[model samples]
Target: MDHLINHPGILTAFSVIIFIMLLLDLGVFNKKSHVVSNREALIWSVVWISLAMGFSGVIYYFMGLEQFTQFQSAYWIEKALSVDNLFVFILVFGFFNVPKEHHHKVLFWGIIGALVFRAIFIFTGVELINMTYLPEMDLFGHAARINVVLSIFGIFLIVAGIKSWFAEDGDDGDKDFTKSPGARLVHRFFKVSKNYDGDKFFTIENGIKMATPLLVVVAVIEFTDLIFAVDSIPAIFAIAPDDPFILYTSNIFAILGLRALYFLLANFMYMFSRLKYGLAVILSFIGVKMLISPFFHISSPVSLLIVGGILILSVAASLLFPVKE
Candidate 1:
């Protein structure tokens, strides 16, 4: 942690490599079409996710065992949370009727924005956690604060999970990011078009100008990301204990994979109906763990086990009980 915080080379290198990759992805690979195929998406997904894990290993080898553990825990929590974003992305694309090839472009921009916003968030969060220290002996009080916050998150997940579980029944739930508090404010002030023009976000058609549904999809993607940020950020804290490097690296890697993940998993999303249950359980568990972290001091090993177990169980359940078309 000390090494990473002090040495600035890591951030610079990470940015240069990631940006270059995106250029290749958009400018080279996904240069055409808006709709992506599951196979192509999965290949890209594997490439990036493998890269991320490999990067984590490098950090571990260079930094130390301790930092690596922190990174892994944070990574696991974030990876799980990202699955929720899958459903949200599906909704955004469905509502906007975004073409497959164009989805990559949207996510390309999204990754850029998300990484920037999250950097600010990580820096601020790390500073606060470091500066503020509660009485060590008053484990009771410390635990209580942790519990209160975690419980709130847990409750949020429980509700979200329940909503997701029933979502298949045609309940729209709170799935629309465009209707979020901030997005709503933006919409009220901006004059927007009523329909789409393929990949074009804004254009003049005949005598009138219009904003494409693609633009709306982009808006929904960004807003939904922020909401996801809220849940994911807290979840990571449960594991890595607010180490900025671990938090940031884990988050960025998971986010970096999202575009590819979406492409790969889009078609098979229904197959993972049990994933909702897995995510729900994971979220609810993390919320509980966070709420009681101080009281219980749950070992990282235990955290790892629970997280892994839930994931396996969920995947198994999904395989066993796929949503039939």
Candidate 2:
């Protein structure tokens, strides 16, 4: 809270940047439904990453290396976990047989939902952490305060990581997305047409207003992001449980770039075939950090180094041992 209050300028800058970029993205570049080309996706990806990096530089200047590293660590962690979301996005679009041109619109609305839900989760989670700290006690010859919520989240992440590591490929590829809770929620509220009406989320059929598949797809995507947040949100809490500003800013930046990433890598997914392993390791490592925080502290720079190294190696390994189609 104090971190947020003290950094009003940075916050304003972040807000302005996001607002302008979103306006340019939706109002100018993507005003119409169209398939996003690889080249355009690449440029957007670089732009978003550079923006995130530049923001971290500002943090370094104003808040010191610690906050900068925290931002970097959280940004990359959210970015990495977001790859899993891309896989799910591919699945959702494919299942619905959604047109490539419509993908951007769905993802755009999905990210808008993420910006809201992530703020809620990060801010609420921080408040929960602030309230759940147990009385100070000696542990292994040192005094410490254990956070109950974080400990639970730690155990959950460890289990999630182990499940991810051993999980079979295409686990979601065969599922029925129409049965998705998001889809169900949309269905519960409105009558969904069997087909899409261009990229519009609603249309008139039989002289009655009805929802389109695009809207259902967007709903499913929103729900999907919320589910992924369970793992990612808790994972980042290990980095800066006390600072929602660092967590939320880094998170939103990572998420706002995802639509581009999805298009850029959708065809070249073999390049990230080994990424699940890296994500599993990162999740487990953060989980361990949370569990051991009461007794030992790991600095942000070290965590950043470990995470960056793992991501690099994972990409290298993926290229070297590419998945055979």
Candidate 3:
């Protein structure tokens, strides 16, 4: 529960670094819109992973082993949960028929919005937990103050994980943008074009400023990320409930590389057919851990090993026994 790196200097430094990296990524490297090649995606994916791992080393050097373990646990959990987000991204892009060349544009803006929103969610969650009653209770065979807010997060995760496990895949059902309340509200208030005007989200047509289909797709993508964050944010909270720095940094690092990860895995999504079950088990385990944390303390290393093992086994199983068409 010790916040070793909760200093203004550290926070400010990380914020600046993240801002500069984002500028370099979007402004310099990906300034043009084109289909992201496998090689490019693979290379960037490694870059992002290496950056995250390197940050863990920095944490270990400055904060010691305990904090480093917490960061690793949070990072792995967030990264694993993000795979589900990538799957949904494929669905969203396909649903809108977003051109391959424009996909990065939408995702770039989507990630920007996500970073802002997730920061809000992280700070808000920490404040709410701090406001709750802190009663010394026996948790995990140790005397610790039980957090009502965290327990609620645990319950939500358990429910969500169960629901996700039983949920059917490839079932878009009857949902459409026209049926979406947000889409309808936007359409009512703005002038919308039926077709895309290149990759522009806005264009001047007949002397009137209008929104393009691309704008709609971006809106949908942003909204979808917000929905996904509902689950992912809490999952990370379960990993590092006491340290907002660990939680936020891990979440942001996992998300920053998602565009490349999306490109790498989008074509091979079907190969990981059992990933949902693994995710379900992981979420459920974390939820149980949170709930029982008052009575049984599970160390961060144990958590990391278990989560990594589940994901690895699920992926291996999927590859060994491919789903039949």
Best by TM-score: 2
TM-scores, all candidates, are 0.83, 0.98, 0.93
Tens digits of lDDT, candidate 2, 195-292: 78999999999998999999999999999999999999999999999999999999999999999999987988998999999999999999999999
State each candidate's clash count.
10, 0, 6
Pairwise TM-score winner, candidates 1 and 2: 2
Name the regions of candidate 3 deviating beyond 4 angstroms: 1-9, 137-144
Candidate 2 lDDT (Cα, 0 to 1): 0.94
Give the poorly placed runs of model 2, Cα more than 4 Å off: none
Rank candidates by TM-score, best first: 2, 3, 1
Query: Residue 241 deviation, candidate 3, in Å?
Result: 1.3
Full candidate order by lDDT, most accurate first: 2, 3, 1
Give the number of the best model, judged by lDDT: 2
Candidate 2 lowest-lDDT run of ten: 1-10
Cα RMSD, model 3: 2.1
lDDT tens readout by residue for model 1, 204-224: 867666555566666667777
Compose the digit string of candidate 3's lDDT tens values, residues 1-325.
5574556666676688788988888889888788999999999889888988888887878777777888888888788788887877787778778899899888888889999999999889988887874879765567887779878988999998898899887665335755455456667878998878888988888899999878777777788788888988888777777688888888898889899989988878766888888899988998888887777788887888898899898889778887676
